[model samples]
Target: MPIKQSGKRLRVPWRKKLDENGLPLTLPTYMAYCAVAGALRPWNRLGAKTIVTLVTTDDFYFPLFAEAARYFSSQIWHPQRYHGNVLQCSDKNFRHEAEALRDERAILFASPSYQIQEDDRLLSDAVVSLGPRSARHAEAALRRAGLPITNESVELLLTEPWSRLSRAFQDRRDALQAIQRLRSLPKAIPPAASEAESPPSTPDPTLSDMHGFGSSLIEWGYDLAKDIADYKAGIIPWRDVENGVLISGPPGVGKTMFARVLANTCKVPIIYGSASRWQEAGALDEHLKAMRASFDESREKAPSILFIDEIDVFGNRGETDRHSAYMRAVITALLQLLDGFERRKGVVVLGACNYPDLLDSAIKRPGRLDRHIAVPLPDAAARRSILKRHSGVTLCSADYEVFDMATEGMSGADIERLVRDARRAARRQSERLNSLHILDNLRPLVKLPSAYVHSLAVHEAGHALVSHEVGYANVADIKISRWRVEGEYRALGCVEYDVGADRPRTRTFFENAIAVCLAGIAAEIEVFGSFSQGAAGDDAADLNRATELATAMVGAFGMGHTLAVEKFSPNAFARMRSSNPELRREIHNVLETELERAKSIIRLQRAAHQALVTRLVDVDQISGAEVAEIIRNHRRPTVSLAKPERRAAR
Candidate 1:
């Protein structure tokens, strides 16, 4: 029967190369067989005046040689065969038979198992055999075949001696043709409009000239910049070199851009791909093609980096049969390629995702994803940096306070938008920009009411107070607005808290949890004598998170000293979002207990709370400076008598 032939295969065990019998069969194996067949072409085409023996000592290689001979005879040119012209001799008799045929012109293909010596009678016309081991074997074989070569060039010779030369010639010819075609092309038509008739001209010096990062929270972004710099310096040794990294953060946090910057800093060619592009059925296959193309492109330009943005879309944790099978195939192909890292040099893989937990476990394992970096919201320092970078304003003082209170929970993108809106407002106001214009533009940032603002303030302040008082969270800033602007989201208050550098540690402090959650509502009740829905969302989230943590501590972790019950249930958030009668009753019970505890704490600091609220209501927008002044003048020392003394700390 004719030898079956198709695409290339390799005997890579990891890739399921061999059959159940452990026989030699794979794309690489087939390709190698074809390679040998081509190598025998010179002799096959010469019409065989003398016997040329192709011998393989390794049993694994017998099938490969036989296939090669058969393929060559059927697919390529065939030579006249004498009685022993095309012989597959055993290793024991390979040397003796070759010596007997020394007088005749012939080709001998034998494994490295047969050593080559200068005095060996048949050395002149012998070509050494090679298995799927080292390229050096091919080099030695070529040398024995009277074509001395190096390992570097052996791949080309063994794979395609004539094809390589042909490819180079074709490339040169195509390049010349392209240049000639370009030269022959017609010139572009000039703009016929006169200067007066043309649209107003504006000089664009740089692509980024008009496209700045905008009023970003530069101070908050300082740490991010440092992290980026550290990344550039390769300071953070990736925990797993084999597995790619997962970068998760809020939207518009420059995740993709960060990948690009890292790639550029490393001076590596980026194979930038997106999961969105591969969402369709056959899209992943096309992506694989592009990936292969990128490798080729990288070969021409080494040190390649493949940046996959929104990687979760491709590697989502789901059954393999669900979604596109092509996607799974693509992932499998990528895994195969990744596993080939030992053979593939200078290729780095980077994957970015906002929902990293949604990624498949197989993709995230060591030697696959290995690294998971949480690019969280920008801190105060980072916010300031982002603002400085994006904002065009050059404040008189380096310690300007506009960003200190304006930005809290805002992401880098949010800060940038604030800057952009401010700039646009300034431009519309006709002429030189001032800080007031920016402030005015930022006034209606959150589209909320005064009642909401007051409620949020109380809520956020509550969080800050309890967090600080309980000694779990360090207070950074508390404001009832967008992190990028003061008096921003009137209904939405944000309290910036530093949970400290001790990570992989539980964040929720049980002592502070209930009080922190009830602070907003308490403040609202204190001022308005009634509660508003302003702090509803935040309260629910915080309460749910705290309760879940506490429950987990009691149940899953067995950390609770008293309640050692292991409560296993999927409805963790059932107590939070549910409005069912029984659930609401349970929630109220839970909340009231916490609220009473919070009330007791606040009662102890009633005077301080009253003074702070009064100051906030009067000021409308209070700086950290003003807060400090108020705290110094009105805050009492007795409220903190129960707490420990301050110590030297970061």
Candidate 2:
């Protein structure tokens, strides 16, 4: 058997290449199979005892390899029948199976990996590794096959593996039909450009449909969209255009949607990928392969936008120890791709994450992902636009205004869910969608409390009252609400005030601000007879601000009792008593004295405080004007008497 005279000639059809669909193979597919076939022939000629070929490819193309093994099994030399020789199994199961069947002659189809276990080498006489096929490989194969497709079509097919092109074509047809249905709807925005069209020269109006439209969150996106449009129209040089932008924001703030709409507006194709999806593609090597493939596909469709969502998952080294080495390698690969992106003109990389700070410093540097834009929560006007877009036609302008007021800090996704919930509520009640239905739906979704509304009212009222009394003068508004179920954190209420544009504030101003901060806690104690955890957030924030102010006054501003400039860390005051026991006692006395002053002021304005709380509890919100009116009506008069004469007589 070892001799060359042991005649065995495997006559596989070397020049014939067919894709999974039984059509003439594209250049990449032909090259990939040819590589596999070529690797197997050498082992056959050497009279190998066993052979296993590990082909690394897109998950969609795994079936094509199984088909090729079957079609060529008869012509290829194998100890087992051609049908039974080709084995497709998961990497984990392959290890166990390879150990049990070491003597069997088979070709195993497994994901690509750089690390081959010792057991695998012991089980097979020969192993061949196949990487993803590149565009050049496809071009060469097409030339050899004498196919009649243009270079552009070849590029398009490169966006996907050869097996997926036919499937993608069918999906495109379905998508077009769906677009037709959407366009027929009442007031529906314009449909997105088909894949064949060039990038648009104007911004898509539907961008406004995204949440946080008027805010800075999407401002950069709009700018990018305009630049893309300009670039496509030949109005600007490609060098002037940005190569990549990082969109950082909270979840459901429309970061992913904004990328999609921007690409749509620019009329360019988009390739959507995510770190989670890449991680799910098998082992570390497979994940890396998938990441490279994603970028490669995006490049194949040049001038396309590559959107990578949840990019924070590939955090910087030292961020997490669980997958340190693996994720570091992933980040390194991504950095390389981003840096090389400049060479591929018309290609832009848009990465999104909730934790931009977690990304490596290298990725955020000037050459790669330099344009970091924050997609903040929607403001009032943006919220209004979001509600109007999601709500039914029956919702008038006034309804939108009301919703905007109600959904003060909600994200776009929250507004959309609220509208859908409201519609469901109306349907359940067998009634037309009305204000009551919307409000009812909102209560559960927002986690609006039926009981603690009064406490929240008093809490916010205290801040407003204290702010006005301290001459803040511009108490913009006071708002109260219960916990929102969909919100990230529980918010009881807030008092918005403007301190005016005054620089180098005096000690008195700092004291006033501290009092305003503590007023909520003080009010809860005064009105409810005990404090609740609702003041925990306010207390921590106010204490920190107040301590910083006290530290600055003593250290930086030289407002201490000794008239000497002494500097110390802000937290040093808390432990000052242990070192300079007397000085620490004095510092403690200062804050105690301020608290007493605040309590005294509250006592004096008890009537005004009660009025404000009552109004707040009744309406859940009040304007600065209403607070001022209550304070004015309940002002205590200044009474002058012969105090000096009385004291002399005594």
What TM-score, to 2 decimals, does candidate 2 have?
A: 0.53
- All candidates: CA RMSD in angstroms? 30.5, 25.4
Q: What is the C-alpha lDDT of each candidate?
A: 0.50, 0.64
Candidate 2 C-alpha RMSD relative to the actual structure: 25.4
Question: What number of backbone clashes does candidate 2 have, counting pairs of residues 3 or more apart or in separate chains?
Answer: 3
Q: Which residue pairs come into collision in candidate 2? A: 27-138, 28-138, 303-346
Give per-residue CA lDDT, model 1, range 101-127, as digits (tens): 653543345554655444443433545
lDDT of 2 by residue, 1-650 (tens): 57543213434333544232233333334555555665565554323445575655432365566555554443444433345556654544655465437645567765644356676677656667554444555555555555544654444434443454333333225423432343354432112213112246644544665657445645666776788788888999877888788888887788877887888766788999999999899998999899889888888987789999998888887766777888788888888888763365778889999999888888889967898888888887776667666664345655544555467667899887887788665533324456677666653345456668777777777777777776676687788754454644556577888876763466665666667767777777777776676554542555555655665665556555756654556556455435665455555565666655556566677888888877877776678787788878985543321011112234
Q: Backbone clashes per model, in order?
A: 37, 3
